[model samples]
Target chain A: DVKVTQSSRYLVKRTGEKVFLECVQDMDHENMFWYRQDPGLGLRLIYFSYDVKMKEKGDIPEGYSVSREKKERFSLILESASTNQTSMYLCAARRMMNTEAFFGQGTRLTVV
Target chain B: GIQVEQSPPDLILQEGANSTLRCNFSDSVNNLQWFHQNPWGQLINLFYIPSGTKQNGRLSATTVATERYSLLYISSSQTTDSGVYFCAGRNQAGTALIFGKGTTLSVSS
Candidate 1:
């Protein structure tokens, strides 16, 4: 079975503070993604990493960045947390050419 | 970029009833899948049907790539099945799955 794990299930941060959310997968997938889910707006991509040291911005990457230092781990960083950034963040990992992806439980970040 | 749209944004059903959820995309896709997000926010993959149909237990999914749409059917619905159903697709390489807003299903005893 594929397993994706997030470092934290919930987090609270003050405005302008830096926040980091970590995600790890045990399946050795090459692709990892970060997305934020909000009411009515659904899930919007924040960033994604295809390989170690390689990352790409998604639809909503303006306030976020990502890093992939190893094949199994990906991290999402909010340079400066803002109140509007409070939302449920999800981390997903998948094989390079596979259609199926595994997701972590999610990190509900509350920016105060 | 591809756009995905799910039908019947919200659905309420009684136990033992059946229902079908629809997903429509704006562009051709290399792959498509259906996922059930449980009440606890865990996403369970239902099917990876780019085309044709596939079934698992009480659930079945049909995807018509040519028409850019997919359908997921739940039989003899149970309260445990109450959750949100999402359809996602890959339209471009090196891009993540573009997901539909989803269909929220609520099952009552």
Candidate 2:
């Protein structure tokens, strides 16, 4: 079975603070993604990495950045957190194109 | 980017009842997937049906790629099945999947 693990289950940060969410996958997938889930917005992509050092901005990439220094790990960084940034963050990995993506248990972020 | 929409934004059912959920996409897709997000917020991959039909246990899914739509069927629903169901699709040029707003399912005993 594929396993995607996130660094935290819940996090609270003060305004303007830096936040980092880490994700690791054991399946050696080539694509990794970060998404934020809101009540009415569903899951909006924040950022995605197709290969090491290669990143692309998704629909809602503002206020968020991602790092993929290695194939197995992907990290999402908030330049400076704000209350509006609070949401359930999810990490997913897919083996390649045209395949099912596996997701990690989301991290509920609360920016105060 | 492809646009995905799911029907019956919310559904309520009793145990042993069956239900069907629908997903419609704005364009043709190379990959389509179904996911069940449990109450605890875990996205569980239910099916990777880009086309045709696939079944696992009491849950089955069918994707008509040509028609740009998909359907998910849950039979003999249980209380544990209460959660949100999401359908996502990816066009040939994109690596990321665009998801629908999801259908919230509530099953009572």
The residue-by-residue lDDT of candidate 1 on B1-109, one tens digit each, is 8999999899999999999999998888866888888776777888988899999999999998889899999999999999899998888553888889999999999
Clashing pairs in 1: none
Q: State candidate 1's DockQ.
A: 0.65
Off by over 4 Å in 2: none
Candidate 1 regions exceeding 4 Å error are: none
Locate the minimum summed-lDDT window of 10 residues in model 1 chain B: B90-99
Q: Lowest-lDDT window of 10 residues in candidate 2 chain A?
A: A93-102
> What are the Cα lDDT values of the candidates?
0.89, 0.94
Per-candidate RMSD vs. true structure? 1.1, 0.7
- Candidate by candidate, in order, the iRMS in Å equals 1.4, 0.7
Query: For all the predictions, what are the DockQ values?
Result: 0.65, 0.89
Residues A32-98, model 2: lDDT tens digits: 9999999988999999999899999999999998999999999999999999999999999998887
Estimate the TM-score of every prediction: 0.97, 0.98
Report the C-alpha lDDT of model 1 over A47-74, residue by residue, as the tens digit.
Answer: 9888889998999998888888899999
